[model samples]
Target: MRIRATAAAVSITGVLALSAFAVPAAQAADAASGKAAFSSASADATSGTTTTSTLDVTFSDMKVNNGKNIAVGTTNVVSVPVTYTLTHPADMDTSSDHFASGPLIYRGSSPDTASNMLISDDPATCTATSSTTMSCKGVIYVRPADGDLMNADAGTWNAGALAVDDSGDHTMQGGLGTTKVQRYSKLTANAGPEPVVKGRTITTTGKLTRANWEDNQYHGYTNQPVKLQFRKAGTSTYTTIKTVYSDSYGNVKATATAQYDGYWRLSFAGTTTTPAVNATGDFVDVQ
Candidate 1:
């Protein structure tokens, strides 16, 4: 069996004795225990038939670091044992079969330790106890560090957050057929709080306006962009409004041109730049 680790994925191929996919192993089938089982030869059948049989197996290149072809600069290794089983059925026919299982392809460390294994291609358990020579395929397990294919099981979102550096541009692809990205808000304890001006009073009619200085506290808040709603004293429904960009630090404000002034709340008028993944900001209210 041959396992090749690439920067993208692990590729596997080879001839085998059994024709089935590898299955995960139970505690009873630990690699150490399996290693012991493959260290002996079989005995003949007890049937009255004059035929007798025996089997012997050996393993090679049981570690990923020892793989023949590996991606350059990728420190991860692929470790999986490759075994060849020789079978003599009834002593009259002798055939050989190959079997491979375990973590299969791993990038770093041993799977028996803290490493993650391949979900599908590789199985923890592998065997060649069949009467005939069984030929099976190799399992190639791989895990990526930065970007990975999307996971459909977790709703339509990707399995992990969209990670972007100060100005890094990254493309996403792969996994479960379709591709998608999951973007999350990037608020941290050290980033400070959203600018909040308690008891903001509004007197004008159009979209509510605010002192630009109050909105400037949130570093990422863009010009007068507002996205929120409100209603007058006797109104049953609320109306939506747009935000105008702020020029002077004190001119920042979200506004609506309605002419009823019983009481109005400041609707946050937020705008985002292109490539929405990096957009995030706080809103302010206006009378």
Candidate 2:
């Protein structure tokens, strides 16, 4: 929402040209963890009954350059200010987009600019085709293909669209409810054996539930191979369990048995035909 520089407790200056700063050394942080937390939805309304028939949003990775020779540390929380301009829905003029600078899931150049910056409606492609009409989805790419550490060589950072569908309130009936929607722009990448278990250090146990994938209109999780890997607490490595398929309700059942006690993460990827990957909805702490 607001873009401002946050000072990390220490600032190293003058050693390098003010604009000649180095990119922070990549750490062992997990991008999947950051994405799962950022790509969530929120709804609001008041008084007579305001409804959001649709909501679309795009995202990008968090980017940083110490333009002023500001020394950054390992603990500095980098903020990626995601900007969105909404073309108010025809029936609703009062709507807002929320959440910014909370996580590092997204880290790359954002396509948002003040002149071309917006939340919902897009000038190039929209059904209404007019500036006055509000659009439902946001066309944002949270990160480019290279940004995903898992497969940096791909060099195909892409854009996907999030869309909310036919949902709103009826003043006459006094009923109000909103349905969350998601759409994945197809991606082409090497579809390999499901994510492998990076070797186990500890024992872990948890259930797997799909969040964003289930909402897409094309595929509904039936007969689809979803692979997930986990590790025990205190360890960064992951271990592959069985390759599970999504059930009718778009849910997967998983149980982890790690060799040691520690933290865990489950990484998801589609089969050979579809090459999109998703991370766990929640982190598991194995004690």
Candidate 3:
């Protein structure tokens, strides 16, 4: 099952300490004893020193979602893949059960004080490449319905990594890289009349819409410029005929002289919060 860290839990400095050691429900019973001990040790360690400690560990070559924008719809859960290289002291055994690590993406300046964050549901799986080097892979799950994302959260997010040892010592690092989270966008076009006299005015209409995380629905992306293009029926080329801006209701309309049989469509250039989209061409016949 996919799990999310609550805002209250993730906003604290010990966020990584708790998340790094999280266990799946199925294994909770068996891990209960170990978890309790780790919690106690963590409390004792925090009482003696600051949470952020310099450790002989570093994360590099970190990549999130294969370096592409993460577009998420309203209902479907989005699973993002993350991979990174971890370098640590030769004596630190990262693959042991006593060690845990994971990657996270957040919108705020720092991971510890992030207003919104996404983290892997489980600890990363690491394979040893040498005594002190390893390759790690993990998945971060985003569920929009669970309030995991808001429309405002769509944009550039900073990547971060964290690791915790058996003794509750932990380190968190941010600014490793960055990734974009976009709202899925949709566009539609329709041209009429189906068969019109040569040189007659052909009206093309369309709408630009994008996912709204707040309501789990697609709403008008108003006041955005969209391109209207035409493709000759027999040819494979589409030339821009004109540029139209979406109205207050996200509706776009344009008129063109129909001189030949062709298809008409609308193309949106997109923005930081939304991905570019093209409407399937609507065919029109000229008599």
Candidate 4:
């Protein structure tokens, strides 16, 4: 049988064949088990006649929970919610709960396990929104250090959806979309001339980096805006002094006149492609 992954379809009928867009092992197992009972009972059959075309299925309004930019390496367990609306043709058999649908994640160039693979928790649990349309929702986790997409496999990853009737007659898979996120960003700052005279300029320098799935290492981010902020030694609020931009190497530098004994730090507001991050405060003592 043909299973669609991304734009093209590949051949694999195993109970659980991993792919960029997969049926998932749990769902596939359920489909395999359930289909055996009704294999001879083909879909859109009329009086046991063999005149029919394949079942029709289409998807719409796909959404990912916790936002689409999947940032990893900060927390271990990342909560992900999968939601989509689909249209099922009237010809197919929808008489029972023999349906399954979920998301699939693959890393390292392909869906092969040697690179990475992730699947939904369940299949075919979507609630019916209309006679021809159904809305399905499920949750999945991205653990950089522990889950299927391991920390070692850091880099760009892909996500998709697969829906099936499990009656061996109709199936539909979502577009081969990207998570568009690498790894969580890390920021660090250091101040020179710590015990500076009352009027000396305090210089703060730092670096910004994030996960690069291509080579599997943290790389510098270039041309991004970051804020230099400070808080009094005894106070908690941090006041923004100036906005500093990261260089081609993701390096940051800022200078401020020593005023009061307080803490100095750099913050990144982040962008559509990355998540916001803040570095720990660096304390400077003024004489």
Best by TM-score: 3
Q: Tell me the tens digit of each residue's lDDT in model 3 across 196-232.
A: 9998999999999999999999999999999999999
In candidate 1, clashing pairs total: 32
Write model 4 residue lDDT over 1-287, tens digit each, in one string: 11223322221221222221223355655655554533343222111111132436665666665445778654456667767776786554443344555655555344322144556644535677667877877666665544344345444555545554554544324244556444678899997687989989999999998765444467788989999999989999999999989999999999999989999999999765567899999999999
Q: Which 10 residues in a row give candidate 2 its minimum summed lDDT?
A: 9-18
Q: Highest lDDT: give the candidate number.
A: 3
Q: In every candidate, how many clashes are there? A: 32, 32, 0, 5
* TM value for model 2: 0.25
Of candidate 3, the 10-residue stretch with the lowest lDDT total is 42-51
- State the C-alpha lDDT per candidate: 0.25, 0.26, 0.77, 0.61
Q: In candidate 4, list every pair of residues with a backbone clash.
A: 100-123, 100-124, 101-123, 101-124, 155-213
Writing each residue's lDDT as its tens digit, candidate 1 over 11-114 gives 11111111122212333234343333322312111212121222222223232323323221112233322222222233322211222222232222221221
Candidate closer to the true structure by TM-score (higher is better), 2 or 4 = 4
Instruction: Please say which candidate is ahead in lDDT: 1 or 4.
Output: 4
Q: What ranges in model 4 sit over 4 Å off?
A: 1-6, 10-61, 74-79, 85-97, 104-135, 140-160, 173-180, 233-237
Cand. 1 Cα-lDDT: 0.25
